[model samples]
Target: MTATQDSVSSLQTSVPPALSLGVVALSVADLGRSLDYYRQVIGLEVLEQDTHRVVLGAGGEPLLDLHGQPGAATSVAAHTGLYHLAILLPGRADLGRFAAHLIREQLPVQGASDHHVSEAIYLEDPDGHGIEVYADRSPESWAWQGGQVKMDTRAADIGSIVASAGQDTAWRGVPAGTVMGHVHLKVADLAASRAFYEELLGLDVVADFSAHGALFVSQGGYHHHFGLNVWQSRGGQPAQVGEARLLSASVFLPEAELAALRARLLEAGHPLPATGDTFTVTDPSGNLLRFGRKV
Candidate 1:
């Protein structure tokens, strides 16, 4: 069972409410090429663009911001950086359409899995940045055991899902209700990562894959909002600024939740680096997470 099904009452008391993920920023080598890939392959509209940077999203909302650098190199090894940026679709029909589009275009799809809580399709961008397009299952259907959400990676029945599309609705673009669901990152150490995300930041450990060198945590227990893994980046350095790597990710919380987080950080001896309406913190793996309220 997932946390949403089993721990609603307890989560309401222990975790902060109204937490949501936001825009993920990246550094890219070629702005034009990355823009074309995101627009054509991923079906995202360019919300804003310039010579060096572009913000791409659906329905006028910004989800990904790509900043271009002339000599940037793409490297996954020797760096603790992004594992994947997950884009959550509004419904299964949307995922079906996307799956059909990928087949029609003969695009390279890496993998697809049923995660109990969500069904996800995995692929990569031109720069080899990982991407996951997924649709969550109903909260009531999710199961939980003990205090952890139950999640498993099984082969997705792509054929059946495509057939469910009904052949009426076509793939247009990312739907209006689409959102930046969660981000999975490769980190240096699981112990340190847990200290920052779970202990100091007060997120609930919804899934523990520590046996596989991974951990998934969330607030309010809908499943994981952030996934930390040490698969490829164990004991690696932080990603260089000029590389095509994850730059930052944002999380939205209410004012009271933010204040509570601040107090917790102070109590845990973590610094609060202020930036306008947001308070930014660097995780143990050096990934930047900015926490703020919705404006």
Candidate 2:
């Protein structure tokens, strides 16, 4: 076995199966414009709003929080930061309805792909933050071999997805069950990221694409909660202060697990500022993450 595989097998702690992602916060160039795009194009409803910030989601659940910084620098492709924030639909029909909505609205889609385990459609916000809308096949349908779940990128069957919409093709909004599925990041170094997320944070390495400069980690046999890659950001710097970029992504875990993770972070010299019921830390590649007890 490769040394990396050995390291993955040796991980001692696994996060609880109930671990889940919460709201993803972003810094955007214009609050109003970003708000409109998210609501109209992405189909999220505003949960709360003010002059400088807006919280949006579906069916009363807050999924995204946008903070506006007037004249903020636009995010560029070379930065080591958010590659995309994935939103998972609860069913294939929901994905089909969303796909049809994009076509009906004439929105520019970045790409669509079938990753064996899920089918996804990609888009970019007004400020260039990447977004992914997807739906998974049943977990039992996934194929695993040699301790790794097999996944790949290929052309999505858009026609079939749209056909799945059946007679109810009208786009209302994202359904109640939509959620923040996973976050993909462009890191400066794969090995360093692996050490931070896999070894230090205690996420299990579900798939390691070291040859392609990418890695996937998760808990409880899910495909991935985090996708780390160096594709465009190899040796790149963090997003500058004014750049429209990911501000923070929140992870929810059991209180006991959170305490254990805090201990791990403290032992590794990562700072944990005092925060009630939650704490924030910066990863090795400068990504901000907030941890909280799952309620």
C-alpha TM-scores of all predictions? 0.94, 0.95
Each model's lDDT: 0.86, 0.90
Instruction: Write candidate 2's Cα lDDT for 131-245 as tens digits.
Output: 9999998877677665587799999999999999899988889999899999999999999999899888888788899899999999877889999999999999999888999
Lowest summed lDDT across 10 adjacent residues in model 1 is found at 6-15
lDDT computed for candidate 2: 0.90
After TM-score superposition, what is the CA distance of residue 74 in candidate 2 from its true location, in Å? 1.5
For model 1, residues 1-295, the per-residue Cα lDDT tens digits are 5455556545532456688899999998899999988988888999988899999988788899999987788866659989999999998989999999888889888999999999999999888799999999987877777667789999999987788688744778788888999999989999999988887787888889999999998877678899999988899999987688998998988877787777787677778764355888789899999888865
Residue 206 lDDT (model 2) = 81
Choose the strongest candidate by lDDT.
Answer: 2
